[model samples]
Target: MAKDFNENDRLIILNLYRTHGDHYTNFCEEFGYNPKCAREIIRHAIKSNGVELNHGEWSEEEVKKLKKVVRSLMKKLQLQSYDGIPWSRVSQKLHRSDVQCRQKFFSKSTLFKMIPKNQIDGWNEKLDIAKFIALLKKLNFPDYNMIDWDYIKEKFSSNYFNILLRKWREMRIRIPNHQHLSLYEIVDHLYKTRVLKLFGDDPEKMKEIDDFINT
Candidate 1:
C-alpha cells in the first residue's frame, strides 16, 4: 500500500514538481514512489493551495499592469530582496496564480525595467554613506574589498554594478582635501560626512570599481 502524504510532504512534492518542471519520473526516483502516486500528491497540493494553473499567454495589458503593481509594492515596502516580493498579493490583484506571476516577471528583462526613473531618483535622494554602510553590513560585506560583485549583481538582478561603483567613486572623490587621506580614512571621512549618493545621472562613466578595489 502507498503511504499517505501529509501537508508538508505534499508541499515538498509540489516544490519538487516546480523545480524539476513536472518530471514525474524524477519525483518517483527521489521518493521511491510510483509516478501515479507522485502525480496524485502534486495534484492534491495544487488544489489544496488554491493555486490556479492559468498557463495562458499573458497579454500586453497584463504585462503593463504587473509592472505597475510591482513598482508600487517596491516603493511601499522599500523592497531590498527579489525573494521578499509578495507574489500572493500580486496574484490576487492580477487574477493569476502566484507561480505564474513570479515566472512571468522573471521570464525576460522585465524585473530590471520594473524600477522607474523617478524611483531611481527617489533612491538617490535618500541614499547616504551611512545608509550605504548599513546596506553593506546587512549584505554581510561591510568591507568594500570583501564584497562579491557577482553575488550582489545576481541578488539585485542588476547588471549595472560598474555604473553604481563609478558613481560611488565620483561621490567619494568630490570630498575636498581627501588626497592626503588613506583609503580606509577616506571611507571613514565619507561615513562622517554622510553625503555620498550612489548612481549618477550619466551612464558613460561606468568602469569596474572591482578592479580598483582589488588592486
Candidate 2:
C-alpha cells in the first residue's frame, strides 16, 4: 500500500513540480517516485483543487497560453523581482525565512497551479534573465574570492543560507570550471555565489578566486 504524504511532503512534491515542471519524468527523477504516481497526484489536484499542468494535448490557443505560463513560472523562480513583487525581498517583508516564506506564501499546489500562460501586464516583464546564469557562473567558475558565507549568514540570517543549502543539496550545484579546484578550494566559490551578491560581481574581486583555486 502507498503511504499517504503529509502536507510538508506534498509541499515538497509540489515545489519540485514548480521548480522543475509538470512533466512527470522530472518529478520521478527528483523525488524518487514513479512518474505514474506523480502524474496521478497532478490529476488529483486538477480534479479536486483546479490545478492543471497545461499539458500539450490542448487546443492551439489553449496550448499557447499554457506554454506561456510554463515559461513565465520558470522565469519567476530565477528572478530578483517579478511584476515588481521583488520576490527575493518578500522574505524580509513577510518577516520570515526564505523557507518559511516559501511555505506560507507559496503552497506547493498553488505554485504549480498558478503558472501564468498569458503574462498579465502588471507583473515584471523586465525581469533579469541573467541571474541564474550568473549564479551558475559563480558556482562553476569562481574567478573571485568574493564569496563569504559568514557575511551571508549575518546579512540574511542562518535560515536564508539554510534554505539555499537545501537547494544546493537538491541540485548538487558545484564548481564546474575548475581546472585547479579541489574540494576545499571550492568553498570560496560557494561562498561568493551564495553569500555576497553585491560585492562579488566586481571583476577585481576575482583575483582571490584565481589564487585560491590555483594554490
Candidate 3:
C-alpha cells in the first residue's frame, strides 16, 4: 500500500527535477523510497497536472535554455557582480522573478548538480588552486599568525573563496605527509586526490579544466 503524494510532495518533486535533473536518485536517497517510487511521483505530476509542469513550472526544455542564457551572461565581465553571477539578467531572460531565478540557480540541489557537470562555468579552478596553495604556504600551514582571509577573498571570488579553503582543508586531512610538501607538491597531491574529481562524470559536463598555473 504505497502512500499517496500530497501537493507539497509533488511540488518538491517538480522543483527538485526542474532545478536539479535526475533528482529521483536524491529523493530516494533522502526519503528511503525506492527509485521506482521516487519516479512514480514525477509521473503522477505529469499525468495529473500536465499543464502545470509544462507551463507554471519549468519544463526540461525551458531549463536547458535558461542554463544557456545564464552561462552566456556570466561570461560577459560587465554583467557580473562581486559574486560573478548576474541573476537579474538571468531573470529577465528566463521571464521569471529574480528571486525565483536566484533560488533555482543557487539552490543546494542546483549547485550540487552544477559543480560536477562543470555547468557553472565562470570560476577558474586553476587560478583558485594556485592562489590557495600560495596562501597556505605564505601562512606556513596550520599557522594563523599572519593569515588575512580578506586578502584571500580578494584573490579568489568572495562567493567561492571559503569553499576553496574548505576544500583545501579537506584535502589536507585526507593526505598524509603534507607538512613537508612544497606548494607544487601540494597542488599535485590535491590533483591526485578526490579533491580534483569533485565534479564526477556527468554526460552533460561540457567544460574541461585548462589548468592555468598563475605562479
Candidate 4:
C-alpha cells in the first residue's frame, strides 16, 4: 500500500517542482525517495485540486520486440497497405492469433495496418514515454497533447527546455534554434507559417515524423 502522504510532504515536493527544479531524477537523487512516490505526490496534488490526470498507454519492450518482428515480416511480404494482407495471413506469418496481438497491444477488436496503428503506437510507444504519460494526465482526455507536442517540436526543435523557451516567438516568425517560447504559441505559429509539411496528410512522412519527434 502507498503510505498516505501528509500535506507537508506535498508542499515540499511542490516547492521542489516550483523552486528548486522539476527534474524527477534530480528530485529522487536529492531526497532519496522513490521517483514513483514523487509522482504519486504530484498526482495527489492534482487530484486534490479536482483535476484528474491525463494518461496514455505505451508499448513495452516485449511489445516492441513483437512490433519489430511484424514490421520485418511486412517488409518482407511487401505489405504496406491495409488491404494487402489479413491477420489470418499474418497469423501464419507469426504463428500468433489476432487475440494474441491484441493482448500485446492492450486492445481488443482492433487491427493494425488498418486505422489503429497509431493508436497501438500510442499505447505502446510515445516518442518519449516520460513526457507523453505526464502530458496525458496533465491535459486529460478529449485534448490533443500529441498535436501540441508535435507543434512544440516543430517550433522549438527540442522537447523539454526549448518548449518553455520558444513560446515567445511571434507567429510565422522564425527564430534561430527556437529562442525563448512556449508550446501553446507554437501551434498558433504553425498555423500561420503555412508549413503544413510537418503536419500534412501523408502517411509515410507521418511515420518518419512520428519517429523523428519521438526519437
lDDT of every model, 2 decimals: 0.56, 0.42, 0.54, 0.43
How many clashes in candidate 2?
A: 10
* Stretches of candidate 2 exceeding 4 Å from the true structure: 1-3, 47-215
RMSD of each: 14.5, 15.5, 13.9, 18.3
TM-score of 2: 0.20
Per-residue CA lDDT of candidate 2, range 1-215, in tens?
Answer: 11365656555666666666645456565666666666665544432333443222335454344335434654766633222233334433322333443443333233334434343222221111122223334445344344454443443223333334334433334457555664445545545544345435655544433442333
Compare candidates 1 and 2 on lDDT and give the better one.
1
Model 3 score (lDDT): 0.54
What lDDT tens digits, residue by residue, belong to model 3 across residues 29-80? Answer: 5755566765776654443323233326766676776667766776776543
Best by TM-score: 1
Instruction: Report the error of model 2 at residue 171, Å.
Output: 49
Compared with the true structure, model 3 gives a TM-score of: 0.31
Model 1 CA lDDT for position 63 = 88
Candidate 1 has its poorest 10 consecutive residues by lDDT at 205-214
Q: What is residue 160's positional error in candidate 2, in angstroms? A: 57
Ranking by TM-score: 1, 3, 2, 4
